[model samples]
Target chain A: MITLHDIGFSYGNNHVLHDITTDFHPGEIVGIIGPSGAGKTTLLRILLGELTPTQGRINNSSSANIAVGYVPQLDSGERTFPLTVEEMVLLGAAAFSRKKPWFDQSEKREASRILERLGILQLRNNRLSELSGGQFQRALIARALMSRPSLLLLDEPTSGIDLHTRQQVLDLVHELQTDGFTIILTTHDLNWVAAQLPRILCLNGTVTGDGAPSEVLTSQVVRETYGANMDVIFHQGRPVVVDSVNNGGNQ
Target chain B: MSYFTDPFQYDFFSRALIVSVLIGALAGAIGPFVLVRRMAYIGQGMSQSILGGVALGVVWGLDLYFGAAVAAGLSAALIYFVRNRGVPVDTAIGIVASTLFAIGVAVVSSSRDRRLNSANLLFGNVLGVDTEDIILVALVTVIAAIVLFRNYKTLLAVTHNSAVAAAHGVRARLMEVIFSALLAMVVVTALRVLGVLLVAATLLIPAATATMTFRTFRNITIASICLGTSFAIIGLFLSFHRNIASGPAIVLVGATVFAMNMLTSTTSQRNRA
Candidate 1:
């Protein structure tokens, strides 16, 4: 649905993204994995049209206009407003929709349905600050679903989450994929997000590798992308990624 | 009956009361966004910063309202720009507010303009309100209220998270400009009648009390308007009865109500515990 031809971005003299060329086809579950300063979040913002690439053009070659759902890092979205979970979710729709101040019956019902689907219907009236991490992540997902978007962008879904919450988010990604939502998420770790995706883009200041996890998760590309040695060990069918430095020292 | 009806008999006194009520409603209406966005200090800053503009207007023979609006609006835009450019919000506000306030003090103290009465500007003269003041206050109040009501959802969303809203295709920049404009209107309107020292009272105090009183933003806003208007009316009565400036009287009433609300809420929470 979208094609990027040689996109580059810079901050002052620091080039955050360098000649990043890729295509996001329809209904593809893709993961972008990179180190802390690899501009993963910057790239996500670029795709969301929130930030303009300092160079190159992004072509939305698809004939039909695509709607996008964006879930920012859960901790970053504002909690200062006296917003209920349902109200926050509905804001996704309201941002795209210039409806009346008072929500219509259908919008309210839709918000309720999404909350129920996310197992947060009981928390529909709870404030954003009142939610736990897992619940907040779920709330963000529910908010994204409010737009019924075909394309969803999640930034750092597991960066600050506990193991259980991480598993829940991974499961949510799986469920969203099954429901025909084209999901793209960014993560610094490979075992969490990249390993689960059908395809992964390894980035460090640019696109280091782009392909399936098996084809691209080779130790060479992993080292190149992360600037450190990482062991890509296969057990049965799944790949177990371990820090080579940590593993070697322990052994 | 004679004592109660005494103030209402005078035409100027009635005008002052009506204008104060309008100021209360508008200030209250815009206050929640201020509190929620945590821009109360900015509101206070802009209010005082307008003193410089009023001084400049007097020295240059310009309309005081126009000068104050320009100053307040410019300050808001400047602060937003600086903050967006990576300056911390507090630092940006602090620098802008203090510089403008200092300039105003310098201008007022130096210019010796007979029309620039420091006492009236600082405390506001309730008896000084005229017909044009009534018309201006009414127009601004009604328009601001209607605009706020119509765009509450969009404003709420943008205020919460502009980046997220932008992803959903909202023009966050435009919403911000409108918010700044609305804020300027509230401050400028209140500045003329309430004085800079007391403008925050109409805004921060009532809105703060409303938030303490209600759970939903809508309820809090409605409560703020009700509380603000009540404070204005009661304050106006007290001002007339005690021969105090209306601005100080209104602030005193608002402060009292805010204290009461805080006390009761604390008691209720303790009881529940």
Candidate 2:
């Protein structure tokens, strides 16, 4: 389990994250929904132990000793880095045990397994720079899985991709969740997440509400957190958020 | 034939050529890391700072090699320290190197010993590569090569992305220190052959030239070493006949090679386009 208690983080004079207290247990996918600049990234960083909180404490249970695989949002762009997909994934393995001289047969097999699972085994030898939006997201996920971490922290993984690709990526995340990986991903894809993920954390600087998709993504919570007036439409027993403000429809 | 045979048969000349090649190989290998990390300027800065150490040695009548080594090591440590303290690595490097270089120039200007020319320190005396200097450069080159080989993957990961490397459990700060130290070692060893001002070019140019031709990491390294050694040998011969500065000669050869490699790559890219 990953736990944070009363975590307050400040950068210089500005408070980025304030009084965050929560424990994320295993076998459940927690989706954090908030507007931009709402400290969702900072909160994720704090959980990953990448950023030390100015106030409060963090504790990790013995089970979650694996490195928290973080897929950052900002740095990755259309531009390509001079590395292969296999090389990128091998970098994740470099964290655990870099004592071996080379990536042996077993390590190569493991990397291939992850690539196959992510449906990008064919692109294993391809350069990372050549991948499209959805392909790159899947590659990043495969790279993260190379470490075999218990908890995966994805920061806006579905941001720049299109609608069909977004659904496919979220479906993959859902599959991973069902296969028992504690996943916490920050995303602006509220409607998509609401339709798929069971639990939700509606946050804006602080947790506005936390419960099932139905309880957390209400009209009042949406307005308070995102400044968005939207209605949750039940389509075939699934929650689909329809933005009345942006869609130019009668509320 | 007497001039050719005598120099070739002599132990000193053989040692000189071997040492120069070794130094070139070491600089070429470590240089790609420097280029990729965007610390090419640091190599130049550190090389120039070695003049301060040499000037100090001249003033105090101490061993110049030892003095240059100390200076390079200290400057490297300072760069590492500043970087660890969250200062920009390039800023720290620029400050330390330029400051020491200025001090060296000032000290030399004020000194009464008119015999030692600063121009020699800036260029090089490749013909004066004695047996002792050759052995010293060779030993250091071996050590640098071994260190680089041992931590190859870790260094690659660290250079590629520090934050990701850190998250993956690589000691990013420690790797930075190691890389800086290796650079210093290569600079100090190649100081006599390339001189302080132009040593960084020797480190940077050959590696950069090879990168344009080679696509993979392994090939880039091998191609860089070949380019470096070829330039060193040919530059030594040309400088011997033309009576030009060996440092500038070597750099010019590297530049020519770099231009050729770049042209070839551009043509190939255009062909594909």
Candidate 3:
């Protein structure tokens, strides 16, 4: 379990996060939803220990030296980088073994296993530029899993993919959650987060709402966080969000 | 043919050949990092700045190589410092490079020393290389190879993505500084054969050509070394036969190879598609 208490962060004179307190238990799958400039990435960076809060403390119940895995946003430059999928995954293992410059057999085995688990083992020898959007996301996830991290944080995992690919990625996330791995992801897709994640944190520079999807994703809270009117409805016992502009008859 | 074998008969030609091979290999080895990290222009900046240092050394009756090394190191550090201040890297490099180059020109123009031949420094005369210069180049090359080999993985991580590397416990900033210093040393040592103007070409063209032809980092690096050395030898022979300046000949040979590689790779890619 990881707990953040009264977390506040300021860059120079501009405060980004303020007086936030939250606790994340093991095996929890949480989605952080917000508009642009909502400090979602900033919050993730702080949790990854890349940035320190100016006015808060964190408590971790896990043992010392907990490994945190992160899949950053896709960079266009990474497409041109001359690394095969296997080599990219091997970089994760390389980070742990600082003393050995070469990856041992066991490390290679681990990378292969992770690629297999991610259903991308066939692409292990393919260059990154050759992978499609969905395959590329899977490769990045495999790279993150190579560390066998206790906590996994993914930033915008389904941003540029098609709807079918998005659903497949969400299904993969569900499978990972079933394996008792704690996962936190940030996304702007409100409907997807509403339907997929067990818990949602609605953030607009601070934690505006935090609870189960049904309880926290009310029309008023969605409006407050996104600054746009959205209609929330229940279909087959699951909540679905429709944007006001696109809601033909839901209004 | 005697065209190539005749130059090998002279001791100076043999020595110059050896030095060219060594410098070419060093530049080739360091080229990938420069291209991968987008520091190709930094080589231009540091090499050009070496002129100011050379001029300063001449005015003070010091070893010109020493002055060039110090000046290049300072310029590299200044570029690093400016980048940290939120200035875009290319702008910082451009500002520092032009300023230092102007200073070097001013110093040369005002100096009354007759022995300091600016033309020789700008366009190198590889035939005039001495044994001491060859020794210095060899020592620097060995040291650079060892450092790069020892930190190969860390440096790769940093070059690919610095933020991710930092998150994984690698000291990206320290590696960057050390790499910059090493690059400065390379530029300074290479000035003897490639000269200030063309040194950046030696550092850039080989890696770029390799990148066009290869798909893996290791293969690209190996290809770069081979191409660099080949260009050096071919350029030496061409210069010896045609009575052209050695530095321009080497760079022209490299440019030719780059163009040829570009053409072949594009055609192959089209064929694959």
lDDT of 3 at A60: 94
lDDT of each: 0.84, 0.78, 0.84
Return the TM-score for each candidate structure.
Answer: 0.94, 0.87, 0.93
How high is the lDDT of residue B55 in model 1? 88
Give the lowest summed-lDDT range of ten residues in model 2 chain B.
B3-12
Q: Is candidate 1 or candidate 2 better by lDDT?
A: 1
Candidate that would win on TM-score: 1
Clashes of 1: 0
Q: lDDT tens digits, residues B76-123, model 1?
A: 877888899899999999888888888888898887776677777877
Q: Among these predicted structures, which one has the highest DockQ?
A: 1
Clash list (residue pairs), candidate 3: none
Look at candidate 2 and tell me the lDDT of residue A217: 69
Give the DockQ (2 decimals) of all models: 0.68, 0.39, 0.46
Error in Å for residue B17 of model 1: 1.6
Candidate 2 lDDT over residue span B2-49, tens digit each: 544554765645665777788788888887777776677888988988
Error of 2 at A240 (Å): 5.8
